[model samples]
Target: MTTPHTVAPSERPHPWDRDAPHAHVDLDALRHNLALLRARTAPGVRLLAAVKADAYGHGLLPVARALAAAGAEAFGVATAAEALALRGAGVPGDVLAFGPVRAGIAELVAADVALTVAQPADLEAIAAAAAGARARVHVKVDTGMGRLGLAPAEARALIAAVDRSPLADLEGVWTHLASADEPDATEPDSATHRQVAAFAALLARLERDGLRPRWAHAANSAGTLLLPEVHHDLVRPGIALYGQPASAWLARRVPDLRPVMRVDAPVTFVKRVTAGTPISYGGTWCAPRDTVVATVRLGYADGYPRSLSSQAEAGHRGRRVPVVGRVCMDQLMLDLGPDGDAELGERVDLIGGGAPTAFELAADAGSFAYELLTRIGPRVVRRYPGT
Candidate 1:
């Protein structure tokens, strides 16, 4: 008799699974990227995993949980609501709110999420809302990034104001780098260096005024890997954690940054078309010879860009096939050549591991990896594997 066998309940497959389009997020790969960053960071510099934009479209709660397990010291979000989401998920880590205080300043204080006071008004609002509550905050000096940050002069005034407020706790001083991803960023007088120098000067002045925040951070993904000087006390890495290279320097420095997400769709139909037959809408692409066209179950509405219709290629069975004609809102046609052999129900790799990467698709679409990941539509379900 055969040996007695038992199938664990966990081994059972999903009941409603079928050929469908979905984005796969590898929890192991996410953990790997965070661990790589921790090893590369400067000594005593903590890691603040940037989970804004739904962890750059890799799923917020899943990515946050993985980062926490990988030893992330804190999380960085752009809004109080994003921070609160982390707290609601029982995410046990310091959440630093880096965006401007548009609203809900008190709610952030209530959630124990730190704030980035970029202006005097923000400080006043936070101080009023934080009355009798120790409101943790990181003063955001503009430095050189002309975005949502207080200028050096204004930052000085705000720090002084915070000093007078009993409800405020100056936990950190931080800035955003504008060109740390650019070439020659570390060169003398480069924009990246200039930003860091400006931030350093502000920190010195604050110290001289007898005010000090325990945390001082400026390095983003690029700065964290390329410039050590900007790694003041903490580094916030965003795209890199999701395994997309944040900069050319990081790509070269850390060669093992594994991409954690892949877009996959099942081939819905395969049809043979005669020569001169136009494919898809607009008749833009006509077959030069009899060809087999495979239609996959993804479209512009699913985050597959229309711009990639004629410019990019999708992967099928370890082969490359050009996308032909206009990408419809619900489907697109792939020119599989005369001898192309994609069977129905076979999985097609649109963007992800061992296929045309998000970077490649972005370059073809004249965009960037960040847009590709974040633009993936909500209609497509996201599956996390190997957790």
Candidate 2:
């Protein structure tokens, strides 16, 4: 059987000791978001808070604990290490490993954390590790995402093998939806319904063989909001529960979702430059008039995409200021315009209230908010306030 104990203690150095720039995560907002996710689920549906990528760069263990205390039924992570960290932190609830677990299988199964099985060898290995310790395994069917899981027929055979194994208990079957976040992007129809239909077909096949799992899920945050019909037995709420909506559907459906992180940086230097003076590398930005240029310590290295140099805005004492010039690796400059009152050491809002939302940042940077949040660098200090 898989060993129930393998994870060591957390060794991460403090992530908030940086001097350049920082991002603060509000625990109150985290709690609020967790409550919102809890409210969305039906009476018996369990909520799995996807806390992978260090809880989307907000710190995994703490975020997981906050979610659990707020009523999340489980935690979902991308790696076995993350799962172990959650387990180490004493997070109560299921911790699902979404990615490959190399040498950590024994420890993972021993800890009673659920793992996703996509390949036959993975199934065999997990079964061997679990032995008779009763480890719950979720079968991931590559319905439409094309990323993980076995094909429909292949998935059935794998499930049968897993069922026959004494080491594993078939806990759930899940599929991912790729187009759920943006259904009307190109085609005349949303592939969300198609993905859901495929998941349903796979589940139906599993049921036909008398394989009734304890859970059946296919909804990511977008799926939960855009396609409520696919809520299934469990709902995996990731970005949505963190307060940033996955898409327009989530914004419309879940109006109460609050953003949890606010990225703020101090204005290192404020200088008034003439109209013709260029700002930062390559003179990419020229002042329309004599303006106050505020140099900010935040940059692409800190998860503020360089592509947003021209489109991003920061709030200075509640006044919106546009970003000017190219965002460098360690610093960026903002235009306080011709008439400016911003001073040195003034607080600038990068991703918080009175500032642009993560949505706005994604749009400005030509990417997804999920990527933006998860890519936030470790150098940025995360301050969790209002416990």
Candidate number with greatest TM-score? 1
Instruction: Name model 2 segments beyond 4 Å from true.
Output: 1-20, 128-134, 184-189
Which lDDT tens digits does candidate 2 get at residues 317-377? 7788888999998888988888786767667888867788887788778897889998888
Give lDDT: candidate 1, residue 307. 93
Q: Which pairs of residues collide in candidate 1?
A: none
Write candidate 1's Cα lDDT for 197-304 as tens digits: 888898888889988689999988888777888888899999888888865565676688889899888889999999999988889999889999999888998889
The lDDT for every candidate, in the order shown, is: 0.82, 0.79
Tell me how candidate 1 scores on lDDT. 0.82
lDDT of 2 at 366: 85
TM-score of each: 0.93, 0.90
Error of 1 at 67 (Å): 0.7
